[model samples]
Target: MSKIDPELKKKLLKESQAPFKGLRKIVWIAFSGSAFLGLFIMLAKIASGNELQLNNLLIQLCACIVFPTLLFVDRNKD
Candidate 1:
């Protein structure tokens, strides 16, 4: 078995990185993914002969890029 204690490894990982950095990153990725999916849905509707609103598609794309980055949120509790 490894000699290092589990708690020690957990503590070491916490100390080595800023807490909540990973959380914020994950949230951003999820937000972007959802936005991309929304845009894709609109495109699919158009392919089926349903009218796709260009503005809505553009808005979704912009939201995917802008929403996640809008937060100047950073892990300050290092």
Candidate 2:
């Protein structure tokens, strides 16, 4: 077999290392948006004096906190 060109080989390696980078970004944005939206809804319920279930409030709070923390960690990895 013929040898591969050095530049092309390097590019291939880089691309392979981060396959689906664009898709990953889109998923991250979607999750983060949903997390924030859930948090907003919870806040609105509180403001309107509607009682919230404990588990749901906890889950939303965790989602709101966890997604951004993960995003921050992922960013600093780059």
For lDDT, the strongest prediction is: 2
Model 1, residue 10: C-alpha shift (Å): 14
Which digits, one per residue and each the tens of the lDDT, describe model 1 over residues 1-78? Answer: 879999999888875776666777777778877887987888789889998678888899898778566434542444
Model 1 regions lying over 4 Å from their true place: 1-19, 67-78
TM-score of each: 0.55, 0.76
Q: Worst ten-residue run, lDDT, model 1?
A: 69-78
The number of clashing residue pairs in each candidate reads 0, 0
**Per-model CA lDDT versus the true structure:** 0.76, 0.82
Model 2 worst lDDT run, 10 consecutive residues: 69-78
Give the alpha carbon lDDT tens digit for every residue of 1-78 in model 2: 749998999978877987876676677778889999988989999999999999998998898888777676655253
**Candidate that would win on TM-score:** 2
Root-mean-square deviation of Cα positions for candidate 2 versus the true structure, in angstroms: 2.5
What would the TM-score be for candidate 1 when compared with the true structure? Answer: 0.55
